[model samples]
Target: MNGLDLGVVGNGTIAGLVNSVGNYQWLCLPRFDGEPVFNKLLGGGGQFDIWMDGLVSRSQSYDTNTAILRTRLEAEDGAVMEIIDFAPRFETRGRVFRPASIVRRFHVVSGTPRIRITLTPETDWGDRKLPAVRGVNHIRFNDGELAFRVTTDAPVSYVLSGTSFLLEQDVSFILGADESLTDTVDVITLDWEERTRQYWTKWARSLAVPYEWQEAAIRAAITLKLCVFEETGGIVAALTTSIPEHEGSERNWDYRFCWIRDAYFTVTALNRLSAMGTLEHYMRWVRNIVAQSKGGHIQPVYGIGLESDLTEEYATHLPGFRHTGPVRRGNQAAEHIQHDVYGQVVLGVSQSFFDSRLISRPGIAEFRQLEPVGERAFAVHDTPDAGIWEFRTIAEVHTSSAIMCWAACDRLSKIAAHLGLPDRATYWSERAAIIHKTILEKAWNPKVGAFTASFGGDTLDASVLLMAEIGFVPASDERYVATVDAIDSTLREGNHVYRYKTEDDFGRPKTAFTACTFWHIDALYRVGRVEESREMFESVLSSRNHVGLLSEDFDPSTGDLWGNFPQTYCMVGIINSAALLSKPWSEVI
Candidate 1:
């Protein structure tokens, strides 16, 4: 219930979602898929210099359909200013926020008030060497032996550039209110700020949002889009990776690459906002995946922006967030075969066509490949696979995996009918029915009256909540009701929703899954628990950082966001849940 304890309790754990006051706590320079250049939110400042502070009242919000955050700063000395930060989005995507870069501009609105500025950089998350006195107002970091200039508008008063600067640690340069050090830095000219303001204001007008809450959604969408590299149209799951699950827990991972499962949600969310440019870019990425083998089968994830190599690496130089070990960069799970991803991909593309007035010609052309793709998924519909949970343990016959296959087939059938294709609609329909029956019989335990986490496992799973979401079971079905009850009683601990607590064959206990929690709200709404659904949704939203962004998990006690920051699936849950909640019963769930 209390606001997130980002500063003290979860110190250095990337508090970008929680902080305000014109301070940037986390950022990975140049590109989202690149190693972090500035990551103060993960604890003890990252690789870039930051210098913006004032005794000012600050509030943040998006400007309409754009992902730009406008921060209004009211100084204690009566000086007022506004700062706009946005990453520009390309129109090749639709119905989503797509600002390209995080541009910050400051302007005086009232009396002149001095602001404190600081610039800091974590060179390679502690792997790069820092050369002192490199620049009068800057420092050069050796990230991959590449020089990064850390420049700012602040004075260099003894900075805490880390004791391990020789070991590639983070560095900072503080800027004071006094004008004495102004000449030492490259102060952003007023013309540049004016130009940025005009550009953003004009771009905001181009977005098509229907309500006041649209601003926040816009920001969320844009931030998600920014995580996608434009060159490859690959959407990375998050900005930073390998922030451990809990104190000393070794569940750290590298999420700075693309996930096939996320493509569907990303496309659907963007299409809804009419962000055609973003949608097209990702669709291109998907097409490339399909082209790999001329089939729809997909790996669980891939390297971002055409980076074929996704080998995982341990960052031995930088201490992990709060000293959690095993900081990593690339995702070794790139070749993973999660069966449920096929459904997610189909659903993402299908929803774009079904729900929105916004359509892209190129996007549509790419989506038409589903017929061949669906056949490939059908080829292995019943085979055991890495399930949606991505367990490090042994693979299993997860009920959700089968249900997702059914979904893929079911949607493929409809899309075929819509497009007037001579597809095997009857075959898909029959196969889908069989898949549903198999799940109900093999996955269900009558005594528990709920779906098990996997075939032969006694433990119930939060994935049971998705039985209604994918239409595998009617929301009003008696078994569906019991499944929700089972999940709420067992899996729901306070506000956290663990995937399953029992250690698998690999001896690793899965952490709480945030997307599953959001899926619970959808299940609740589908079964006509509208009021209860609203309450749950609000409670989940409260778990978000101050900026309304969620990570992979939230600590029930301290409200610290555990796992990666600005997670893609969590954001997908936000968009989908919002859609379901906003619809009338007769229209949608």
Candidate 2:
């Protein structure tokens, strides 16, 4: 029941996760950060399921070039039904018609099918169920601040009583904000579906995909795009939180908030596919966040709407996934001083200034605003902070954070030069050089023959694998090669890679981080282990679920994806690995 078998549909305002058998398992209403409307994925919660009572078989797939999910269910009586689920989103007049709605259409495909529909929506994290009021043509559920209505052509009494009925013609259901349905469900759904298909297909065609592994890359691209909170131009780490990096490990934390580092990787991958829309929006979002920060004192994570001070707490009422208790909300990491974000912000925005394709090319004003971030990077390159892994109780000058600081100054030098500011370029270039030398001097351990995870420390970590990717060290350099070898020996369990083996808040991680495996694969490719890298990439790809989706973590021994569903970081790894290992487009013809 991992996310690989689930399909996600979003209208840039709200999203829904539908299983292969047509169950709306996980969804946060109104916005990505809102309370859950269907949280069955987290355990003992409510769900909206239009399923066959005695289902014999089921098949699921997405509509061509769209996020629309289609599930075909076969009952033991040989009756078949096709359920199409989508969040209504399309251009309406001058604005996008992305109402807070989850539209479901049921069409009988074969003999009379008995379908039971359940629309039990629980609020307050499944502590209680909302009271429903039946109307002439709709059913409204009142849950204090989160009232919603279900408009359908199906019998209201049948829906309320959960009565299984024979399907004759097509029926439509729209669960959304409490509003009147001015048009017929069939006509409205048909129009939205066609327009939504066109919208996605056009977006897909616009991508500059590599000839090989295009399908995998596209699926990943779509998933990553779905993670974006369009109103704020912020992208979440994953759609759901508290799925557990390792099952019942008490490591569950809400990932619904935006992490600057994760969002940077996301945009970087999307940039590779020439998806400038997200890149542009994210660039603006990062700028706003930087502007809001006091003297470039930035946190690694923030709310989607740029709200700081996210207090982490637990929802003890709701049982976690697989009955794991204490589902968490509001990330405590928001208060952690993860210095790597300064570099990530600069890296994410620097390209827009130089890239010609961007609609709004950043200029001198933007560069001036960014200089403060670089200054912060220079100041914090040697400071202790929560490392990229976000250790709850640990703080250190992580090599990864230091290297990112070096990258920030390095990119600033290029951007400065591009703007014809030679003085600024020289200053940034010198700062980058000094930081680079400092990292090599303090972070490298000659005894271990690799760059340690922290400055002057002996612990090996998987993050050192990014040395080559970030241009801190060339892939062919002896130090870099040794670092990769050391990490491979220490962190690699079979083909999967763990972020680190050190004890943290929840003790050492028990499962593999999927993105780390991709990072290992990319590092292998860079070190000219082409065959090994290719084999490893395929192995990781094979671990993805049925719909070519990946979660935040995976049990390497069992090949079960854990953590949050359709994690943007993991999805970005798929896109990046495919592009990095794919054959050139010249060979496609």
lDDT of 2 by residue, 11-113 (tens): 7778888888889889898788888979888884587888686789998888766788899999888888999888876776897677788888898888888
Clashing residue pairs for model 2: none
The global Cα lDDT (0 to 1) of model 1 is 0.61
Question: Candidate 1 lDDT, tens digit per residue, 290-327?
Answer: 67746745778887765556887887765677777678
User: What TM-score should be assigned to candidate 2?
Assistant: 0.98
Q: Per-residue error at 12 for model 2, in Å?
A: 1.4
lDDT of 1 at 94: 48
lDDT of 2 at 300: 92
| Alpha-carbon local distance difference test for all models | 0.61, 0.87
